[model samples]
Target: MTLAKAAAEVRERAWVPYSRFKVGAAIRAASGKVYAGCNVENVAYPEGTCAEAGAIAAMCAGGDYKIAEVYVIADSPEPVPCCGGCRQKIAEFAGPDVRVTMATTDGKEKTVTVAELLPGVFSAAHMDRA
Candidate 1:
């Protein structure tokens, strides 16, 4: 199954009682394994887990530190790109050229690279230079 489809499928499992906005994410690890996650919102607000973050955590738990590609899906009029935190997280696990696919539940889709999502990302390389 495609990454977008995987994201959409997992979206059904999201725990979003407040905003009722469900989001899903899928990441392809360098090890060729696909990890998927859904947003889990909490009542406290601002303490919810993003779908992309959850997916990355799963990838890490699976022992994969590199992301080959990513897909995010949400039920909106346009494709929903990752938030700022997720954009940075993507840059952490993927190279600048890694493809990030953003999609709407109704089939609208857009593709951008990690660098496009977050230009001049603060990565470990920059830290190493310090």
Candidate 2:
């Protein structure tokens, strides 16, 4: 299924009780497999899981570490962007040019690359001893 559809479907299962703001994410792994996730909120405020992070976790659990494309959907006035931490997490598994599509439930969408999402992203190369 398409990333958009996958994300939209999973969004319905979000465990959001505090803000009632549900979000969903889907990733197309380099293995050509699609993984989907939904945001899970908790009463602890910041302890909740983000949709993008959950999708990445699912991808890793499925044995695919590389992300080719990503889609995120939410109910909002405009396409919702990933949080700063999710952007960094995505940059870790996706190349600079990987496409990230953010969309609103009403059909509005905005596309950007991994590089655009997190410029000067910190990577393993930065820790190389060479």
Candidate 3:
């Protein structure tokens, strides 16, 4: 299945109660495996897990460290972009050229690279700066 379709399918399982906003994410690892996850919210709010984070976790669990592409789907008036933390998470597992696709349930969508979403992202190289 397409990444967008995978995300949309997983969205049905999101555990959002407070906001009632469900989100889903799918990531294609460099190994060509597709992992999917749905937002899992907790009553404590701050402890909630974003779909992107969950997907990344699954990828790591499956022994893949590089993300080649990602797709996220949400029910909204417009394509919903990843949260700031998720953008950084994506950057951590993906290269600057990795494509990130944001989409609404009704098919509206936008695609951009990880670099475009988080320009000049913090990397290990920054720690080497003198």
Candidate 2: 10-residue stretch with minimal lDDT:
41-50
Off by over 4 Å in 1: none
Candidate 3 at 125: error in angstroms?
0.9
Prediction 3 TM-score vs. true: 0.97
In candidate 3, what are the lDDT values of residues 1-130, reduced to their tens digit?
7898889999999999889999999999999999999999999869999999999999999999999999999999998989999999999999999999999999899999999999989888888958
Candidate 2 segments whose C-alpha is farther than 4 A from its true place: none
Error of 3 at 108 (Å): 0.4
Q: Cα lDDT for residue 122, model 1?
A: 89
| lDDT order of candidates, top first | 2, 3, 1
Candidate 2 TM-score, true structure as reference: 0.98
Error of 1 at 5 (Å): 1.8
Q: What's the lDDT of the predicted structure labeled candidate 1?
A: 0.93
Candidate 1 to truth, TM: 0.96
TM-score winner between 1 and 2, please give it: 2
Query: Cα lDDT of all candidates, in order?
Result: 0.93, 0.98, 0.94
lDDT of 2 by residue, 88-121 (tens): 9999999999999999999999999999999999
lDDT of 1 by residue, 1-130 (tens): 7787889999999999999999999999998999999999998989999999999999999999999999999999999889999999889899999999999988899999999999989888777753
Q: Show pairs that collide, candidate 3.
A: none
